[model samples]
Target: MPCRTNEELQNLVEEAKREAPAGKVADYIPALEKANSSDLSAAIFYPDGTCYSAGDIKDQFTLQSISKVISLALALMDRGEEKVFSLVGQEPTGDPFNSIVKLESHSPNKPLNPMINAGALAVTHLIAGVDVTERLERLLCFIQDLTGNHSITYNKDIAESEFETAFLNRALCYFMKQHCVIDEDVEELMNLYTKQCAIEMNSLDLARMGCVLAMDGVDPLNGRQLIPFHIARICKTFMVTCGMYNASGEFAIKVGIPAKSGVSGGVMGAVPGRFGIGIYGPALDEKGNSIAGLKLLDIMSKKYSLSMF
Candidate 1:
């Protein structure tokens, strides 16, 4: 029910652009450093198959951490809740997404949750595949089905860049392997994980994916169940709890929706039965969320009472 017109959404986007100066593009990944910090776009997809967008909605970006949500759903469908949770905890951590402090401090040595780097690696390990190619294909197929965009594919440049610079992620994989949480080759896992994170799409595709989640795993285009209902619920719960890196609690208080954000400055939001939102602004806050994108969501949440809370 939010942003009934594209003009209304554009107005919100312009207002939110004011916050871009307070943020910076993510430069840790050498490839991501090239993004235009001021670039912002958004799209909203409804269950009725209607969509409205504003700004540079056609521009594409890698999924980065947003892939965690999709991977988690696939992992759940591949491995049941019991097996998956045994390797990753359900609790949210206050630490940064890439921090390794919890793995050392926690008794079980399992990562606190799947949204973090360590836990996501573990979940990715569980993705059903005999080799990296097959696993990556499975994930890609799932994403394609979700968005109804079969052209969705990983950016090879970004994937190679991330694979080359993923020292911290490698460490997480090795540590999890040591604890018996993951038993795959660290390098192979890194290869698949990097490619998973590098999957690319524009705001419209991202919104369509979110709309699938909003509809509890049913494709709004044809009512086909792409994800199981219980699995979708679990993924949404994690989004509410740990989706925006360390800023999730604040995001919940202010935006009050089930959402996930990536370091690529992309946020995917599912407002329960209402609609799905996709936002992209390369300017990132200190917590790695899209600065203007967050503001845009806040404004929309307030103006249209879009918050599920």
Candidate 2:
């Protein structure tokens, strides 16, 4: 296949937008249900210092589960890898994101990995922030540093809505507590986790953040060390193994890179020093991944040979 030029890539994106299926937007949260199903945006950051974008590249959307990658990296940096692993496993559960069967089926019931809601809540519990305000401050500061964008903040409305409907996550946190996996208060843990997921970002900002992980924790635009190399490696590994809820396996087989997707219609891909991709499409498959976003990634990965493995 011939390589696609920037102009051709832009055209391909437009064409995808036109034919993309309008899958279900997450309805558990009323706000997410209000998102435009046809909205699609994509941005790519290449290692050679070039950037390409099309569609609603500048449109802002909630990070949702995409924030998991960020907080997991932060927790790893704040604590050592071994310590973090003690609380969260690295294996993919092959279960639904919010499934509770594994917790009771296995001894100790530790979460299978940090990419799931259970694992993510465990990671958030490990953060040193003593309270919700402190945790949000640290998270915001890290986002600002990583993106070089000071305007990033949580969408309070989204946070409130998730908090209202977070029964499953709340139960997961309590289970972790019962199993002695987390030491923090359960409500505090929920607040920190929910607020992190509520962080607002557009495709371009997320692409830049993904670039940090792609560059092995170094912020390419400023050369600042946002996360340690080992931390970045572990986060990428988890993303590859367990990022897309139950659909993670298929995505790894098809896209062949470490990527994470959110219910808010955002997907972040890290190419391990080659490039980072950010795409948003509010409609999701049954497993809570962006349908159009996945299609776009599949096409681009095949065209550019962007898979890490």
Candidate 3:
């Protein structure tokens, strides 16, 4: 079915937009600095192929950190849990997502979890392909299947910008490489990882992808098992434990859904057999999550009794 304009959701969006000014857009990437911090949008996709949306849902944004979930899923599918977890841990960290302290302090020199930058880089290195082109194509194809948007691709400018300034990520790669956690060349891995982060899509597309995870890897519209059920469960588990940077604990208490947020002001929520939600608001809080988007989910979770806890 088609996505219908939702006035109730629109009202929520307007209310959430009020929180935008209180947060700042992610300026570290430089390319993301150009976004309109005042803009907010949302879309909800149900299993029956029905969708509800509010605000400018068509606005596109980079996946940023949210791409971690997808890459983790793909890595699991390619290398299985044993090999993938050997390079990264399953625990959440109290530090920032991009922090390198854990890799230095932790035993065995592995990242804490796949949601963080260090762990995500390790997982991306595991995606099976002969080269960056093949690996990226495989990931893009998987994403295309998930969103059913064949035209979806990475934002070249955003990818270039991130690749150029990813000093911290490069450090993470080298650390992992030195420990033999990831054996690939750092530059090629960085190329793949940045493009993965730069994958672009709108809230509607994001919601649909979330819906697939909500359905436990099945594409609700076509009934295809896009990802293994157990692997999907693993991804959702991480979303609950570590998806929202360091604020995941508070998010669980308030929103209580399997969700991931990107610095581009995008939040993708999977309501597990109920519905999927997508949100975009470029203004980021100190923790790098979309401030307005978090407020929006908190409000919706309470008003609609959406907490899965």
Candidate 4:
């Protein structure tokens, strides 16, 4: 792999920011409604250990669905593959991320995949500690190790906001419980899920986290093994199949990498053996993805030939 200097990568982010206004910011979350629709930022870590970043890369944002990947990875490490797979499927549902139709209609009522809230909630239940607190601590430890940053912590305001307006998620939890798919207390599991989503960090932290997945579950900069290779491969596969909510197919065609997006206007793309890319633009498209972030990845992937395909 050729070396990409910080300046060149920064230039890509600026060029991509020009497309920010092409979409709107996500407003359903209420707290996320205040974000500037045109905000754009990107951080990329190359194989040769260079970090390039530009725009609002330093702005703090919640992980939202991006936490799903981390939680699932932890669950895999704790329970291994068979148990996790039994609770969640790998197939992509073209349906909405929060769709309950399959849960009601399927025989066992398991979630379609780990990337969705349903699957992620299931994965979270399998986190395998005595309580939710321990599980969350484990998750935080994994994230801190992956990022090589110990200062990361959850944003209480964001967690409270989601907890206040998470009727849909609560209902989903009940549905899973009704089917006996979730064995733990619904309140505990949901609380853990919400907090995981609310853990705050900027693009630099996310890029470093992505570095773990990009390096096949090892931190490239420090060579720390945060997750098993199988777990990383599974998470990356899910990202490619279902990470962008309903836009996964289109994104795969355009960016051609295993990527995940969250309602908080964050996107993490893991380019195997090359780098982990993170983007933050509070503005979102209909699919709840950072609109400007997607455009930025499309632009960078094309320019640098970073597509996994």
Candidate 5:
């Protein structure tokens, strides 16, 4: 097959947006309720340092659940694999990302995986910091360093808004604490996690972030080993198995790439030694994934034979 040119990618993005129904935008958070339901964008960074983008590629969105990917890697760097896995299992829950069933009924009360809300909160609690602000700052610095965007920062409005309406998350953390799974105070850890979720970035930023993992933890732009190879491997493994929430298995079979999605309509994928991609389509499905973005990745993956399997 011929190489995918920029025009073809742009055409594909437009096609994907047309397929995006007027789906529901996340309104549970007052801040997220403001997203334009019609917005769609995508960007990719290849190992050669070229960036390809289409649609609303320059538009910004909060990291939302995608922040878990970076936070998980940092957690491994901070807490190490043994301590991290002891608190959160490395398996899919088959329930909603925020479901409380497995956390309650499962043995040891560990979260099913780090991609879920419960697991993310517990993982955030393990990052060492003097205070909530320090912990959040550390996360921000880590992402900025990897993305090479010094100006990257959080959307405090979203963080505060999500915090105010974070009833379910609060309940989950409280339960984990009671079960001896979480180490930090519930409110403090929630603040850290919320702030991390509120970190804003465009598709290019996400593509760059994914590119670091594409190189197995080394930032290609600078040649720095931002994360250990083993740590990046673990993060990518979870992304493949549980990153798309309940649709992960289907995505694996169809798209066959290591990817993570966030409720803010963002998807991040790393193509091992080849490329890193980011997609955004605010219209989400019942499963909370970007419906159009998923379709776009499936098409691109098939067209280029990007599937690992």
Candidate 6:
């Protein structure tokens, strides 16, 4: 297989956009439902220092569940992996990302993995902070440092909307609390997780962020070590195993790269030693991933032999 030129990659995104309507934009939350379902965008930054973007690359969206990557990494850095894993299991849950049955089934009630809402909430609870404000500030700074973009901020409207309608998540956290998996104030834990999920970014910024992880915590552009190499490795491993919710196994087989997706239609992929890819297609599959974005990655993986497997 040959390396795809930027023009060819952009063309692929355009082609994938046609399938956007096969999925629907998430409407469970009022703010998320406001997204333009037809929109699509993609950006890629290679280790060789080339960057490319196409379509609505300027459009900003929430990180949604994708913020779990940062929260988990920060937890590892602040606390040890042993402690974090004790609270959140590393295995993928075959059930839905937000299922409560899996939590209750385990003796310790550990979340299946940090990518799901249950695990992510636990991970967020573990972030070292005096309060939610301090935790959010640290997490925000970590993201800004990773992307070298200080302008990123949470979408207040989206965060507030999630806060207003997080009854199921509240129930889930209380269950974890019962087992001592999450001891933080239930509302505070939910607020912090919701705010982090509301972090806004565009395709190019996300690609740059993914490039840091792809390069194993070092930014090729600046040669800065933003995260420890081992922690970054752990983060990528989870991305491969559970980043796409239950569809992660299929994604690993087809796209075969380390990637994470959010309900806001953003997919971040790190092709180790190659390039970091970012995609946004507001229409979502039932699993909450970007429909057109996954289609494009599958096509590119086969065409360019990008899969790690």
lDDT of candidate 6 at residue 168, scale 0 to 100: 91
On a 0 to 100 scale, what is the lDDT of residue 270 in model 5?
Answer: 90
lDDT of 6 by residue, 79-192 (tens): 999999989898888898889998878766788889988999988998999999999999999999987799899999999999999999999999899889988899999889
For candidate 2, what's the RMSD?
1.8
Number of clashes recorded per candidate: 0, 0, 0, 0, 0, 0
> What tens digits encode model 4's per-residue C-alpha lDDT throughout 1-309?
422566676676677677667778776677877778777777877645678777767799889999999998988888888988888888899888988888888767899899888898888898877887888898988888888779998988778788888888888899988887797778888788889999988998888788789889987766667788888998999999899998999999998999999988899989888788888988777778887788778887787787778
> Residue 154 of candidate 2: its Cα lDDT?
90
User: Compared to the true structure, candidate 2 yields what TM-score?
Assistant: 0.95
User: Residue-wise lDDT of candidate 1 within 148-209, one digit each (tens)?
Assistant: 99999999999999999999999988898999999989999999999999999999999999
- Best-fitting candidate, scored by TM-score: 1
How far residue 93's Cα lies from its native spot in candidate 4, in Å, is 0.6
Compute the lDDT for candidate 5.
0.89
Worst 10 residues of 6 by lDDT: 1-10
- How far in Å is the alpha carbon of 258 misplaced in model 5? 0.5
Task: Specify the poorest-scoring 10-residue window by lDDT in model 4.
Answer: 1-10
TM-score of each: 0.99, 0.95, 0.98, 0.95, 0.97, 0.97
lDDT, candidates in the order shown: 0.94, 0.84, 0.94, 0.84, 0.89, 0.90
**How would you encode candidate 5's per-residue C-alpha lDDT over 1-309 as one tens digit per residue?**
213566777888888887677577888888988888888888888766788888877899998999998999998999899999999999887899999999879998989999999999988888878998788889989999988898999999999999988999999999999999986778887888888999999999998889889899998877889999999999889999999999999999999989999998999999888889988888898899998899899889888899989
Clashes of 2: 0
Estimate, for each residue in 181-298, the C-alpha lDDT of model 3 and write its tens digit: 9998999999999999999999999999999999999999999999999999999999999999999999999999999999999999999988788999999999999999999999
Model 4 misplacement above 4 A: 1-3
Could you tell me the TM-score of candidate 6?
Answer: 0.97
